[model samples]
Target: MGIDFLHKAYVRPSTYTTCIILTFMDQITYYGGLFFMTWATFERHLIIFHSAVFNTKRGRILFHYLPILSIFVYITLYYISVDFFYPCENHFNYLAFWCGFICYMNLPIPTLLGIELIAHQVVPMILIGIFSLALFLRVIFSRQRLRQSIEWKKYRRMIIQLLSTSTIYLIFTTPFSLNPIAQAVGLPPMFTTPVYAKVSTYWTFGVPICVPFVILLSLPKVKEKFKPLLKICGLGRVVPTR
Candidate 1:
């Protein structure tokens, strides 16, 4: 919710209070989710393929938290520095708040666009793809090494869930991630088309909307938990005919 709010703040007009809220929330949600999810994928890799390292106290602490802390620190410093170099107050643009800010920054336009593209899309996509492929390969090799089909069956559902989630994430986020890059690479009309902006908005916000449906579909366990709540709300009754 906070992340979406910050995204909205880019196009919406902001007073002082809202600007501060957006500034802080943007850093936390944008960087927080990116770092956490990426690290979680890596942790899953360690757990599945190298449990020995994952079980160690030092490994647990380092893998579990060090990346998050580093990201938090980096985000804090980066935003502070961006604001210092390109103070929002001085270069405010209610029409295109974030785009304006980025273009007005001391950094070269290409460098700024490249940084955004790498940070938001390319890097995350690469990390997810690599980790997910490793996971798939681990599953295959584990089956060969264990020689007991039942041994890996228990993890099948989890593997499916991860792969499906990652696929959906990439599908939904790729266009938005590529938008600026597209604009930079002689595709300015791609974004200028009114339909593209609206479609992009839907895709951007559609991710969260789709996630719950994905979770319910991917994990029967989630549906099981939700079923009882639905029954409590009188929405899970079955009709019978005599």
Candidate 2:
């Protein structure tokens, strides 16, 4: 009875308030979902790419360096944006607000927001689309070769995990990508469209929580395995498995 009373008094309201705040925050920040999706993608890519290489000290150092390097590059680009591509005062319209919301959240603000319509939205979509297309072509053309060299059963789980992750990431990002083009041509706000705002906001919260759950489900042993992997990669001392 005490536990139940405490739960009712504290937990429920806290959870409800958190949900409302997150929804409002997401609504105000156009690219919040996309930025999170990009971060997730980058983390997953690092894990996959360095899984083999992380066995060595030099490789582990390099693995650590990549994210740092990415940060430096982002900073440099921000500097360039501030110095060179300053947007006109009249450019910050309703469309620009949405784009700016996305830009400011992910980037340093004002400067990055200035060029975000082109650099963040359009360029990224084009690059991601091209990369995805190339991956698809490579998969289709190389299937026979892969069949001979790859261990189908062992890799099957990893492949499914990767595809599921990619699909979810793309779903979250696609709307933000397309929103720029739509806004450029003077379409209504994506949220203002029937049912889209609510649906998209739900997705914003759902996708991150969903991906971790999916990873847990598909790789049932991930939590157990990851501790050992971290130790093996010299990230920390191994915790003993029970």
Candidate 3:
């Protein structure tokens, strides 16, 4: 009965569109997660530092600014993704200009090819490695401070929740980042060699499904929280409001 209700609810076109948009947005954000991570980490630091100085007004301003900044960043990344990373069928691949020239013109190609290979493969790997290490250190330091503070008990669960979210994000994204690197270096297919590409894809897409469930399960007041509103609508009898 519950399954049928959910099936009917999800059958709406708007619902399906929302799901599609969410999937696309999630994937794009995963691709851009490294950039978002940098900004998010910086925002965390700013909030921590300004906790005392930035009263409700300034703190509210900062809170608003972070989402705006993130949206702008995402838009910029969308431009890069559409224009540069994955050019359209009619678009020229300027990134491949040199490679094409060398391969076709046969003009002293080895050095140019090597340079292209390194630029495409080696540089990104190095950057991601450094960024991940920096993020790990930042998280560790922040966690240690939280542990030492008097509010440790109050914040402990929240800290764990954030860490779990970060872990899920990393699990979803790390493979996508590394997959191209491995392929570029001529490594055997991740799937055929005991590691499966489909598995990575599944895990990446699974994050969106998993995150909401995790939040819903962890948070208290699942029933009382919405019961009053549902009762007002005559959807069902109201349980006592918490």
Ranking by TM-score: 1, 3, 2
What does each candidate score in C-alpha RMSD? 4.8, 12.5, 11.5
Tens-digit lDDT string for candidate 2 (1-242): 21332345332233433333332343334343343334444444445433566678887666566655665566455544542344522122222212222223344423444366556545644554454445445556766776765455664566566557657656765564454455446666762353563355344444566778677868757767777767788887657899
- Model 1 lDDT per residue over 78-149, tens place: 666764455334444554534234323435446664576567565776687788888888778677876553
What TM-score does prediction 2 earn?
0.46
- How does model 3 score by TM-score? 0.47
Stretches of candidate 2 off by over 4 Å are 1-114, 121-133, 152-154, 185-202, 220-242
TM-score-wise, the better of 2 and 3 is 3
Whole-model lDDT per candidate: 0.63, 0.49, 0.47
Candidate 3 residue 104 Cα shift, in angstroms, is 20
Query: Which runs of model 3 end up more than 4 angstroms from their true locations?
Result: 1-38, 45-50, 53-64, 76-87, 90-150, 184-198, 222-242
* Candidate 3 lDDT tens digits, 1-242: 21332455332233433333433454355445444544454444444433453567766666656665775676556544643344223222222211112121132324433443344334443554454455456557766676554344554454444545556556665564455455556665662242564455445665565666555645567646766777789997557888
Q: Residue 223: error of model 1 in Å?
A: 1.8
TM-score for each model: 0.70, 0.46, 0.47
